[model samples]
Target: MHKYVRMAGFFGLSEPPPIPQSLRNPRGFRPFHFAPDDRIICFYLDFWHVANGDHILHPHALMFTHSSTLSNYAKYLSVVPDGQSRRIPWEAWGPSNARWMEGNFDSSYYSYVHGSRFAYKLPSSYDDTGETQIIRMFDFNPYAVRHSAKVVPAENGEEGTDADGLRAYEEDMTSGITHRDVTSPSVVSAGSFFVDDVHSSLPYREVARAVQYAEDFSILIDEANIILLTEDHTMRVHTM
Candidate 1:
């Protein structure tokens, strides 16, 4: 056996989530994992624009590698139908996962699951491989996107040294971004995350539509970080 295989045998996980039978061939989606927090968010659609009578609904989905972390990485786990887990070589959601999909779908019109899911990673060691920590995933629903940083703190020494006169005017003043940009964060890459409307009251298609466009949203962690995603027949991520 290879050296890495031997190491995995010593400290490897037991099992991961499995793909649902109906969503197997199509690969419905992967559960989202929020970093610094253990919350998973899942997204899926019940109906499509086609008029085939509900058979056109494709479910299976997964995230792609945008960050350097999963540039050439593999899967780690999979979710089963019965809530059981299994281990896989691919790195869908590993130990670094943080946030995930939750209840956000409703049975309505003008709304549907646009993309797959959004996810993040926490600071973790990749099996003591001495590899640098990083975040990476696949873009689920590709589209146009943009992002902007709401400055909380300015760089050092640039605040305010002296006023018009030759006197110390340290009152914490700097050129603020007074104008709002019309552009939003560009969706660079979609995170390899997926969610199911496992807890919905209406049909799958109805729930998918409502959740896809619903504006009511809650971010996982609120730190000195900013992420923006958009849709234009593709997915993109803005890292600022």
Candidate 2:
């Protein structure tokens, strides 16, 4: 018996499945989805194992819903081959790299694993299809940027001389020094009408123009809404 099995038994818990001889001990268990209605939990198990005499670390998943105890649960739909040697990076091991859309154990549940870009759908008991569906394969580039034209000055003019030149020089220096001073707040408010006009005229102007990287991607789903947290630090909510 594995040490984990003995430890669980000591706590009055049922013994878990024995680790395969080809696989090493598992580490880094991360829970992803929970269905309160059905008392179901989905989680990832990361481990290092020897495959073809090469050591590799990868992740697999399990779901506990109908089982009588924690030890007995449904393994993920896919399993790593015994001799497969794929080394996943240590930094990539976490819940942030995955997302889940929970459904009442009666209809449908969805999950996406980042590196694989595969969306898995598990149907409920009421589903007549009785088959799992993988759909909508899409590539995600977190560092994707929406390119736009750069702003440029329409024309340049020579500086005026004497009084006008001195005044302009002073104004330029003062502008640079005070650009972010307390007075700028009032100045911005004072130009509220102009700001509104600019906004209205360029309705499509990007407020926070920045590239979104995959690392900053986040998503949340509820019964009536889906919320996405993008790289630009913006929350986009969509109704279901």
Candidate 3:
């Protein structure tokens, strides 16, 4: 039951789109597979992509191990129950996962969620000043996932090689990469693998102040209304 389970890294969020960016059009992560016992999960949200040089804004939001509020409410819980699926196979998706997405979130990419190692979730050695503000969850339980090789097939020999070396030298290279970035394959994830900060247990009735410094957001509780999707792509509706 512990033959493998090593995934730790973090720091994501900031792909809400701007400068002609829309809503999650090939953004990232969105998986699910839960049958009589086939368990699996995934989710995505980037808060509107920007970055260090673009100024600043690399928000974060993800999912995977959700065994239904472990207690203390589990940061108000992020729902996702009821069968799930979404195809998968394109060689698992690049060099398998290019050694866990170029490696490093300390060793991963700020995400992991395979829970149920007997309801895994421990850390009560002392701190519990009445839940102080709960905001820390990291679980593990992977069966098999060790990937490598993330994308190779370009040998121009110079001028950029093959992720698009100046358009393969200039106009019509035969390789692609959206615009740039790719071709650093020395691979590592040998396979593949793949939270934080809180406060707010229902109070804010509305908020979308033109996103001055909004970090991350996502909501959709129905029975009436309450659909917020902040980080500046705007969308606020509260009626419930």
The most accurate candidate by TM-score is 2
Model 1 CA deviation exceeding 4 Å by range: 1-86, 89-92, 95-98, 107-150, 153-240
**Model 3 worst lDDT window (10 residues):** 200-209
lDDT of 1 by residue, 204-240 (tens): 1000011122122222211122232223333222231
Estimate the overall C-alpha local distance difference test score of candidate 1: 0.25
* Cα-lDDT of candidate 2: 0.26
> What is the C-alpha local distance difference test score of each model?
0.25, 0.26, 0.27
- Candidate RMSDs in order: 21.4, 25.6, 20.4
lDDT score at residue 39, model 1, on the 0-100 scale = 17
Please report, as a residue range, the 10-residue window in candidate 1 with the lowest summed lDDT: 202-211
Ten residues in sequence with the least summed lDDT for candidate 2: 178-187
Q: What is candidate 2's CA lDDT for residue 156?
A: 28
Which candidate, 1 or 3, would have the higher TM-score against the true structure? 3
